[model samples]
Target chain A: MRSDVLVGAVSILFGMAYTVQTLHLPKAMVGNPWAPLFFPLALGVLLVAMGIVVLLKGLRHHPSSAKKGGSKRLIVVTILICLAYTALFERIGFIPSTILFLGGLLFAVNGAKAWIVNSLIAVTFSFGVWYVFEKIFYMNLP
Target chain B: MELIQNLLLGFSVVLTPLNLIWMVAGSILGTILGMLPGLGPTTGIALLLPLTFTMEPATALITMCAVYYGAMFGGSRSSILLNVPGDGAAVAACFDGYPMAQNGRAEAALAISAIASFIGGLIATVAFVIVAIPVARFALRFGPPEYFMLMIFALSATAAISKEALFKGFISLLVGLMISTVGIDYQTGVLRFTFGLMELQTGIDFVVVIIGVYGLGEVFKNLENIASGGGLQAIQKKFGRIWITLDDWRRSIIPILRETPVGFLVGVLPGAGATIAALMAYNNEKQLSKEPERFGTGTIEGLAAPEAANNACSVGALIPMMTLGVPGSGTTAVMLGALMILGLQPGPLLFQQHADVAWAVIASMFLGNVACAFINIPLAGLLVRVLAVPPKVLYPVIVALAFVGVYTINFSVVEFVLLILFGLVGYGMKKYKVPTAPLILAVVVGSSMEQNFRMALMLADGDFGVFFRNGICWTLFFLAIGSIAWPFLSSRIKLPWNRS
Candidate 1:
């Protein structure tokens, strides 16, 4: 349910952003009634409307199985880990950065024991995938 | 003798050490991805598409086809055991599949799906090899106006899948059309929505969007449940050998026969992808069954029908793509891109121009399906174990793999960012139950549809009714309308045959 809210907020935000961005475009001159902004503006309205409808619907239903909290923190951490991995991937290489990222996510979401076990398994699998993509398939993964 | 010789050549293609290894690897990878939540065959194929660039077209097509069949095979594995379908088509499989699992019949369920899919694929491949030539010739009769109407037919017929409001389906389609406009205009060379980024000039890579939406969004949604107390305990089940009994075969034979053609026909129609084929077949089987209420409770027919239908649909999709230059699904669209990359324009002249390549590809589907069956069948339990890998272990690996895969295409961070954004949006839309298939389909076919419409009009001096003026175009246009109308009409009047 909270996921619904977060998703709704994102939709509304993006829709508004789309609307604002398209507002700068000049209107199509009197040939085809549709302008460049016409579609975007309408889409923005529809998206905002959909978001509002979804938010309201979610509020009314109140699904009890919905998990509360923990995700926000983890999402932030996951983002940081992803950004860090992207930065580190080239220098540290695919296997190492993958180990770190997988370990970080496992620890963040499922705690440290999961982190250790998953990290080991992930490291092994990453090596296999890297071998296939990089060595066999000759994919130039940094 | 000629057919046999051609098939032998196909065997040589599949038997090559590198190609065989890739096929095995693709199935393994596809099965793993399919077992996981949120990642579907499209994501699997899209993630791996760049690998195709380096290989012979035959190897590329076979590897991708193996992955496609493997994912379809694997989709049921999770849905049966975990009640989570990695792809939408498997949702129907889960209705009965999970119940069978609960009854300690996971092996039976898995075996049935494998056999059913194998039969379906075999039927389709045979049809592809034997009938595709004449069918492609027949499809060549369609001109630009006919093509325009055919796309509309494809789009409208998809509404039949919407169990709820038809309006919602149209809304979904409208969204797809909107996304299809996100790059440079095909006619004017004017930018549509790119905010001056040079990377935007190439438009959205269909694969990236597929990865982000289907792949990333699924992870995020599953994360909440995983963090909560939603992860299951004791998924390990003891079972006898993964083989369908004679009785099981008896039950499935009729369904395979019925659904083979059903899936093929559905697959032949544009936008009615494997999921829809599977769904329709499942629904049709339920309606046909004497014990209709047995549908969601682990009926073998439930497994057999959709499994057969979806795989057959793959073959069905190729007819229009090869003959009409209109792709029926995202994977087929990518195959169309493969067609373009190989410098073989698809449409009417393709058969005359590239018969060997086209015939060889059709021939390969026969061999590929057989290879997929071998890979899937005696290995069902091992594949199901792939699902036991917890999300904590899997998500990061997939994300990293996806990122690396996308980045390696051009080594551009801008592409990565676009990939991530699409992932978030795809995830969000998926969470909200907005279907992703139409978006990609629309994008792929959009330029062609608009271009054909404009051309038809220009030929008639900008008259809108030029599309309907010709007898061929008018027949197709009405057929499109009738298809969309038939489902709604059928749903309204309870047939005399509707038992309950």
Candidate 2:
């Protein structure tokens, strides 16, 4: 699918969902017609209108460039690494998690060359920053 | 005399030993961060913000402002040497700056930018001091209706000036406004769009969003390039004298003087900042030059105008932020968030209520600009070497630091997850050519807009006509309409001079 079409479709879905949610919000008290839903409903309508325009424009025009092949894999893999790091952050503790995350990312991007240097850099940065934030700034890290 | 007294009080506050030390330290740190690829003032300020959580408001604000000024000065170094802009505002500098470096005038280019930035910052600070008091006083008369219209005008102006498609800008803005509504609605005691999550009650934190969008999102964008071993590399150059001669100074003085006010005026308009100012100033210089063809080559006017304009614009951006409580750019929006975090409300009452903090910040700008220029000129060679750090190594460290920075705020895993999610969203937005500035700005202003709207409606017993009754309100409404229509109208309206 074209990028604009995808954007428009997502936006329409979001607008509809939010509109439904807004309708469920409690109404304003007596003598007050201005409810919690007023502003969001207005925005929802604007979003739907803008979505239609974007969708039509997308359908009318073709994309100038096709998607490239390799970068998608790199981006996905990196996001997964970050997610894994975040998930294990508190469980494994800050220093170990940071070292693993940094080393993993470095190895993933640069490939497993010079294991000593990569390990050293990962260890040094994680511990060095931890020391500064913990000792100097007095910020508690998990 | 009153201005002089306040300035004296401000100087006393900033001249304290601790504040002065932080200013110098911030300048050095900001220069290093600015020279690094993918980290500008916004990211620099965001990353350093957590450290200031325990300091006095004056100290915290001055340090952050110093960082901002230093980043603006340091941005030109990478632009000149490697033809890679360290920040969006430095993009214009690359045109003439890189060519000058290629022609073996790297030192001269560096020196001129440093001097121009210094002069620009000094003049803009003076302008800021002169304008801030009156702007604040004028804003004291704004009721909720006028305030609402002003925000609308801000949103419309942002949409109009966005480099993306017009509708896309509006879409981004609306999305931000919607996201802002996710927490509990302050009025009527209703839970909004929370979907039963306990954490959603407090709304999304803007600082988390900023770190995610700028820090992690940029990391994701550069991941492929780093994988391919194609990230930024330092340009090798020898620094000789690092000073411009008399001829260079003679040519630069006029352009600097001309571009500073242009930059300042443009920057005072909400959502317009250094990037636009620099681009406009560069174009204006080209038009005024006798040899316009030499602009993209190695021209002193080309280098001086943009360098000065961007620095002036950085200071000019503070005018609205400090006085009217509206951020003129994404960086200023972050600064506003910082101010709020420090328990300071940056509106008209700020000058009256927090006069000490406000004046100290203004005075610090004067000291920060001079300090940054002095440091940058002597340390240009050292700062440029920061670019040599491999992105593969540097980015991961940045990611780690980002996680730690966000975590230090609340120590919540959920917020960390939100950071990663917004990072992905930011990456997607960048891929789709959606402007992030409008979205961030909207997020900053959405709640305030809602508060003003509700208050105005309450004051008028829910009459919509209340929005148009006042002169200021009507003026702002028309300005909003004009701004939204200007982009489409400019292309269609053929001038008489072009009727041939």
Candidate 3:
């Protein structure tokens, strides 16, 4: 029930913010000035309306706490690892950063016990793809 | 004659040694990927989009379509063997397929599934050749107002997936449209909501968003599932005899035929996809059965009906996206994006401008189906080896590939941030029970919908009444309203044959 309300409330807030942004969009000297803003504005308004319905539906449903599954810590750890990988992606270059990214994720997900297998997969994937894209396809990779 | 000529043209292109090699490779890879739990054809194509980045449109599409058919068959393989459906469309197979396997007739079950899918696919492909040209030509009459309203109808019908949470679908589509509204307004030079980022100029690529949402999002969701002790227990798969009995074919022939047309029609309708077609076909078979009680206790007819419908439904779903520019399901929506990425526009123009490409896709469907059947039938034992791969190890590879694909497209890390952002968003959307397919359709069609809408208004000189100026628009409006209302009314209305 709370998830619904939270989603609804955030939607309404975003919609309002979007509408405000739509209002400030520069008037086009070419065609009708209002034409460009029309679609976004309409979308913004519809979102608010839908959000209200969602909020009402949430309120109407018998409130039982939805027992959420999955570990937040694991998800967060994956995100942080990705962030670190992204930060180091250009600085450390493609192959090294990718190996680290894939390695960190594999280890985080699989475990320390399977480090050999995990490292092998990580190394093979990163180097194999990099070589293929850069050398064979002749496509540039950051 | 034209159909034959078109098929010959497509064959000439696809029969090349190079294209055949790609087709075989793609089919095999797609089967492996599809056997992986939680990765459907949508994810398969999205993950593989990078490899197609440099190929010719026909070659790229051939590879993708092979992947599509391979994944379709692979989805049901796991359903029969492990009772774990690899894709949503395979859920119906779980009803009787697992029970048949448990009864030690796993070989019969697998064989019949392939046979049914092949018959359904071939028939549906013939139907596609017959009808696709007419549908494309019909869509040529759609003016701006008609096209815009048609998009509205398509998106709305897609969102009406649930009776209880219609708003969730609305919110999902609105989120997609909102994302589409970013970057500079193509009509006016004004920036809508870039937030002063240079990379935001081109707006977000739907492929990146899709890879993030589907590819990464699925992995993230799987990660969550693994952590929660909800992952499927790995089973050592073994196949018995690889051929179905003559008696098995006799019982299934009727159900397969009955469901093919039903599946085809449902599949062509926007928002009703292969999953629903399979489910409906299963129910219809049960209703028509003389021994309905045998359904849950491992009946050959039960497995055959849904398998036939599942393949038919996928073939039927492609017609709209390839001809009318309205993607009927999420998988088609993803493939629609791929078609556009190939620098060809779908709809009436597709047939006129890139007729060879459009026909080639249909022609490839025939070969793709044959390829899938060949691999699935003889190579079933070899392919099921991929089932031993653990989800924990497999998901990281998907994430790495998705990000690499994203990098190849734009060469920007800003897209990576958006990928991660939408990945989380997609995960959240799934958790909340919001359908993400409508969101993909909305994103794919958002720009065109807006453009047509604005064009209609400009043509009408700001009069809103122009929407009512055409019969097609009126029909679209009526259907859109009906589509939304049907979900709510369906539960209340009692059908004569609704046993449930």
* Model 2 misplacement above 4 A: A27-34, A67-70, B492-500
DockQ, cand. 2: 0.61
DockQ of each candidate, alpha-carbon based: 0.24, 0.61, 0.80
Best-fitting candidate, scored by lDDT: 3
Whole-model alpha-carbon lDDT for candidate 2: 0.85
Each model's interface RMSD (Å)?
4.7, 2.3, 1.2
Q: Ten-residue segment with the worst summed lDDT in candidate 2 chain B?
A: B491-500
Residue B94 of model 3, lDDT score:
86
Instruction: After the best TM-score superposition of candidate 2, give how far the Cα of residue A83 lies from its true spot, in angstroms.
Output: 1.9
Ranking by TM-score: 3, 2, 1
The top-ranked prediction according to DockQ is: 3
lDDT of 3 by residue, B174-200 (tens): 989988888888887888788888999
Q: Write the per-residue lDDT of candidate 1 for residues B1-500, one digit (tens) a residue.
A: 76667666556656668777777787777777676766778777877776776777667766777777778777877788788886877877877888888877777888888788878888887877776667667777776777888787766665334433243344455555556656765545557677777887766665566666656666666666666667754565455787778888898889988998988888887666787788878888888899988888888888888888977887788778777787767677666665555456777677667655565566556666666676666776666676677676677666766776677666776766766677666656655566666566666666567667766765776677877777877777787777667656766887532322
Put down candidate 2 lDDT per residue, A89-118, tens digits, no spaces: 989999999999888877876668857878
Evaluated against the true structure, the overall lDDT of model 3 is 0.86
By DockQ thresholds, what CAPRI class is model 2? medium
